[model samples]
Target chain A: MQIQTKAVNGVLTLSLDEKRLDSKLAVGFKDKVGELIASGNRLIVFNLSAVDFIDSSGIGCLVTCLKLMGPKGKITIWGLKPPVESMFKLTRMDRVFTLCSTEEQALQAVNS
Target chain B: MNQVSLTIDSRPENVPLVGACAKEIAGQSFSIDKLSEIEQALVETVNNCIEHAYCGSEDRQITIKYALSKDRLFVEITDQGKGLDPQCLKKLTAELDYNPSDIDCLPEGGFGLNVINSCMDEVNYRREDGKNHWSLTKFVVPLT
Candidate 1:
């Protein structure tokens, strides 16, 4: 699940270079997040500009990451395509995480 | 009215392929805005068929039928696996509420059926002739 990772002032930003984050990649996505958490990354940001489609399994993988982060840490997602945003709202996940528009905004959301 | 059918092995990898076909057919009948929703609904149903019905066992066949009327697109997906639980609908249709304050309370999965219901105009499930059947309907409109 080749994800692009960047560290900015202790916060890590992970970007999945995939168009569709469906069931096929769900396990790998969750595993990656688990690894990040295990590696002492508490504050994390995800850039999802390239992902235009996300199914329920994708959503579940994201929620699993959030849970892994726990209350002490923060996870912000930015660059949601229309369909992905619609899925976030449809599943009422918008209330759980701050959905940002840009990478800077997401980094700032997670950093602060 | 136009109808088309496609069959694929019960695997997670094949879900997006079927979703793409659904979007292509939906494009002719529905506006562009509804394409993702239509595809999402169909994908969820297919995933359920593979996960719950077929129990993630590959090699089994999952059949999908797409029919287009004047203003509506009907999609029916069938699988020769186990039948869906009758009590599942009540759980899937309930309000998708979560407690952000409690991380454990937040649901990590089980959004498939709920998402399908949210996207499509109608979603139904049935069992007949030793097969599990799931149907989805969407009403289309002009592009503008």
Candidate 2:
């Protein structure tokens, strides 16, 4: 799995290039998200457009990221496909995180 | 073909390797749906051994063995750590109080057993010679 991060208009956009997020990639995932939050990038956007499969471990890693960001630091997640979107809904994390339909929408929300 | 046997050493680092072997075995005979169920089951079971059986201790290795026949896929996952408690399996299988928020957020993980139970047709846990033995099976459920 590869993670690419860039700053756009003070919003950090992270694109995940991976087919699946499971146990094997969970730790590295946590580390990268932690690095982003620690770097003072409060407004974060996750681009999961490329992620096809996600399991419980993957969901756990993302939940940790959300918790670390806190209320002050906003995190918007975008581009979740069906099963991936279903997982978020199942876990009720879809409610906790500000989920956007597109990257542009997330960026717009960040700007607002 | 009678059956093919595949084995892998017990190590958290080796979980994915063993899981792949299980996936291949399951896919050999079953349809895609069964293949996915078995794969998810194996992935979760192996992850459980790696995370909880050893509790992140580097000293132990988790051994996985798979046997595939025309009728079913059988998997045995062995962990050289503290054996699993039967009560835990019962609770998880029943989905008793399995609130997602109750999940721990520590870099160390959990939930392997839950996913495994949800996916597998049958799950059995035992302890022999101080090693945790977990057997999972997903057979072709005959359509009525």
DockQ of each: 0.84, 0.31
lDDT of 1: 0.87
Highest DockQ model number: 1
lDDT of 2 at A28: 93
Please count the clashing residue pairs in each candidate, in the order shown: 0, 4
Please list all clashing residue pairs in model 2, or write none if there are none: B10-B61, B10-B62, B10-B63, B11-B62
iRMS of each prediction: 1.1, 4.8
What is candidate 1's lDDT per residue for B93-123, written digit by digit as tens? 8887677667789888888888888888988
Per-prediction TM-score: 0.96, 0.77
Candidate 2 lDDT tens digits, A1-112:
5999998778899999997788778889999889889877888889999986667788788878767776666777899877567656544567656778999998887767
Q: Tell me how far candidate 1 lies from the true structure as C-alpha RMSD in angstroms.
A: 1.2
Query: Cα deviation of B135 in candidate 2 (Å)?
Result: 1.6
CA displacement after TM-score superposition, residue B122 of candidate 2 (Å): 1.5
